[model samples]
Target: MMKKLFLFFKALLTSLLLSACCELNTDNIVYIVSTNDMHANVLNHNKQIDLALISGLKKHYDALLFDAGDAVQGAPLAALSDGDDVISLMNAAGYDAMTLGNHEFDYGQNKLFEHAASANFLTLCSNVYKDKKPLLNNLNLPNEGRYAVFNKNGFKIGVFALTTVQTLQSTDYRLLNTLNFENEVKSAKKMLDLLRPLKLDAIILLAHLGCDDAPCTSKNLALALTGVYQDELDLIIDGHSHQEYVKHVNGITISQTGSRLKQVGLNVLNFKASEKPQVKSILLTYEDLLSKGIKPDAQTEELEQKFRHKQNKILQQEIISLPFTLYGGEQYGIDLSRVTETPAGDLAADAIMYALKTKISSNFLKFPAVAIQNGGNIRVNLGPGAVTYASTLYFEPFLNTLTSKLVSPKILYDIFEHSYRYLNNLSAAGTLQNIKDSGGFLQISGLKIILDPNSKPKVKAIFLDGETTALSRYDTKRKIILAGNDFILSGSDGYSILKDIPTLTEFSDEQDALISYLKHLKENDGFTQYLKAQGRISYTQLPKSVSAYVKIRNFHQQNKKLKFHCSVDGEKFLPCFADKNGLLKFELAPGDHILQIAEATQEIYLNTILGIGIKQGSNLSTIPAVELMPTKE
Candidate 1:
């Protein structure tokens, strides 16, 4: 009996040990969702992202949502409330965590904190602090640089957040007075020390340092992360570079969904807690929860609608009567670039620039120049219709103030070098292409140059107050004052080509400028005028030589096998016109000639190559004789 009792107790002990070990091995599956660089479009896409998230919450009840900052500025709605309404919406969306993006400082920290009260999410950033406390108060949670721990099916997890150092460099709201972003990795280590004691299952770093594709942003930050004391950090949810990724680097998996609530980085990390912890498999996936078929949450939709009506009331008031529809007028197909003929772009730029000049005339600046961004940036097209204040506000919603800086001649040259990209593909052929590759540098109102499309960018001549002058005669010996918005002057378009420029010289508040300009118009006999291009630009072609074996294909598909036709001063040479199948061959000796390709029946000129060179060497060929569309004359 004693022997049997000993055996029974041993068996029972073994079974219990096995059962306890299996219980400890259970998983804690956590879904991490993150967003970054979301410039608040609260009334439009912001609401869209929120509704999409609410939809996500229904699907993944246990997922944690984090917004990586740059969330409150850029659009008019958020700017109007100074981010208070967006905070209310964010709280409604149940955001779990967030960090301040650079733009957050646009209004300064005091407003940010007041708005923070409106956020239901956990405000975090290991970098910035005031009086030894995180810049944001109510961080009752320990700041030991440790993670926020959550229990899931008997598993322990931790999450932390980081911001970029550039946040301090912005003049948005003057943060240099207090906080500073120390090296990200240094703070990460201090937090790791605190986390080490917890014996956590996995660590997640919510990063806001935007990454680039080449000299990667996240990868660069991750290199810093290698110095971190903890080995348990298995995942990094990154933002900043406004990029998308689903990959692992240096043993840690980093993921970021593209910005503006387009998608959320959804990651599933499997962990094993043993004598030593290890990550099994990290699967990254993006949930395009923002689809048409998916209905938005009823509660979120109701809140968005409430704000939409109020915003519409303010945006719907008529502001002006435009002579022609512009910014892609729906049925009218009007172009803003036709600003000379259509009063839309010209009128808007005039109003804004005039208001700014009037506001800042105390300085002896003369003949101010104003330039708007490219055509693609013009989102809405107006028609011969009553322009509403909302439409104007919506079209130019950034609310950017007018600013100027004294740029050195050398620096201005560098800036112009890059800005030539804008002039290279102008829609109007008659528009001056004479701007040397280096010439289109100046975005101004007091000058104009005629450009030939067929030739390189060499200024034919420039007109200043209707008097033509050779451009080469003018040099950068004198400083030319320029005016533009903060975004433009900042060289946002890789045109950091301007030098000797002050950071930001705010002259007139954007909204104030608009209002003042509008009132000025109401006072000045309703301001009637439009700008039109007053110059001729064309490409003259000359063929140097044409040898035997010159080949041509159908200019158009209809006459596929037709013989090719070449014209030298209106005289036909070659195997003449091809048949319906436009295919032609030519043989000729070296000579000066004009080559023109004409369609068989339409009688439209397909292409004219002036000054084309066929070397005296051997034979030459033109297999595909098609050409780009003609520029607007």
Candidate 2:
């Protein structure tokens, strides 16, 4: 009888213990959903996951939502509304907090403050300051602070934000001259010192610093704080490089979701009463959610559609017609604008020159006014037909004003050299990471050059606007005025050589300039001239009598037959075929020879222009295989 009583008590005790443990587990877990570098892609279109889906996830998981910045100023919606539409959507999506990205300041300081005032959540920025005070405080945003503490699931969570110091060079310096960005690591330590006193359960550093090459990056920040204040920082949500990663440095977690709503990040924290909390990071794509039977929130989707409908009325207005498409980088399966010259780039540069010529009738025009548009500024291709204001806005959306300066020929040489520096170090077998294109690559109007990538100085020769003769690198007789956007003229994108040069004239923004130029082309029937690349830039000086091998890979399995053409030493085009192993072998003469490969198949798109240099006896057998895209038909 006594043994039976004892067994009954033991069973009851076991049930009680399990119940307590389950309650503790339920109260201790916290969920955080994050996104970075969204770049104003609030809708679910063009392979981009929607902000409404993010809202659905947040509600379903009972999670906190935060953006790592660059949330504004890329699409026509943001450009037309100066980012108000994005903020409105973010507010509707239930953002808990966000940090400032470099592009956040694209519209200027007053607009930034206006955004902060309109935000339903906190705008946390610990690094940026002006006149020895936080920028928010200085700008009279007393309600928004550098750091905020939240009580979630019975635990106090501390969150602080940091913006990259590179913002000075990435943004208009004039707009940010008064502001100072603190060193990321130093600011992190300061934030830790302040947050630790409050005895928080977890601390997060929300940063716009990327994980790329760095004096300032989230990875560096993690490494820097690993030993000294390792226990102080629990997690870091990073942005600005448009890379996706979730890694641990020491005991702290660093996570980022790539740009344009490609993926949404989740950090799950499990806390206990006395021990260190455990953290786990995860990234989810739209497909992942769909497979799990998750649907976008109805309210958020309705709100997004309302905004879309309002914007489409203004954005759908037609601007001009085109005979053929102008190609930008990536859309045509090649990095045309950044690595080589494209017709779209040429048009952007010409627009600047045309705007300047029409705006100012000074001697600057007489002295060879050449315009150079940074390839990065030309965001998209124009059109094949019926281009709209929305399309043009997407093509150049930063809203940078036009500026011109008279610079020396030496400075001009430096500009061209700087543009080609990224290409000069490329290897025959370099991967995409190694062959990364520079944003500063110049797309020119009224200039031509022969670029020898393998030589000491990449700019082999430069020609004045209409002059057939090449200008000597040391020539000083002819004066030249350089016209471009304020971003490049003010020394952004490493064009410091052009900085501090007195401005000869200032014109309208880039989009306006492009519109005016397109209208002029329409009136003059010059659209046909822009249908193909103008050969404003050419590659030359390849090794003579050297053999090279080119390999091609077909991306589309539907296309079986393909034809190829080869131009050797800039000679007449000749038919070529790859061997059974799919290798095109080339033997060239010793002089400055140019070898080019063109596709003759209508079913496939040529993705790369393989320009290689080889030694006398060496064959470039290790060159990376080029990709070929097949048409849907």
Best by TM-score: 2
Model 2: number of backbone collisions = 4
lDDT of 2 by residue, 1-633 (tens): 999999788656545532432222346888888999887878887655898899988886778898899888666678668899899989988999999998788788999989988999888899898888898885444334789888887888889999988776455555675899999889898888887778898898889987763358888888888555877788899897667888998778889998778888878777864456777787777765565456788888998899889889878888788855676645434456787777788889999888777755454357777899998877777776789888887888666667777887778888999997876643333211245577888999988988767677989898886788887788655678888987788788999887766555555457667887998998999886665567788767433244555556662342544456776533577887776656666664322223456562221112233333332244543443565545566
**Which portions of model 2 show Cα errors greater than 4 Å?**
1-26, 138-144, 226-228, 272-274, 318-345, 349-387, 393-447, 450-535, 538-633
Best by lDDT: 2
Error at 460, model 1, angstroms: 6.5
Each candidate: what lDDT? 0.50, 0.74
> Model 2: which ten-residue window has the lowest total lDDT?
600-609
Q: lDDT per residue, candidate 1, 547-593, as tens digits?
A: 32223333463434344445533455444654343334344332212
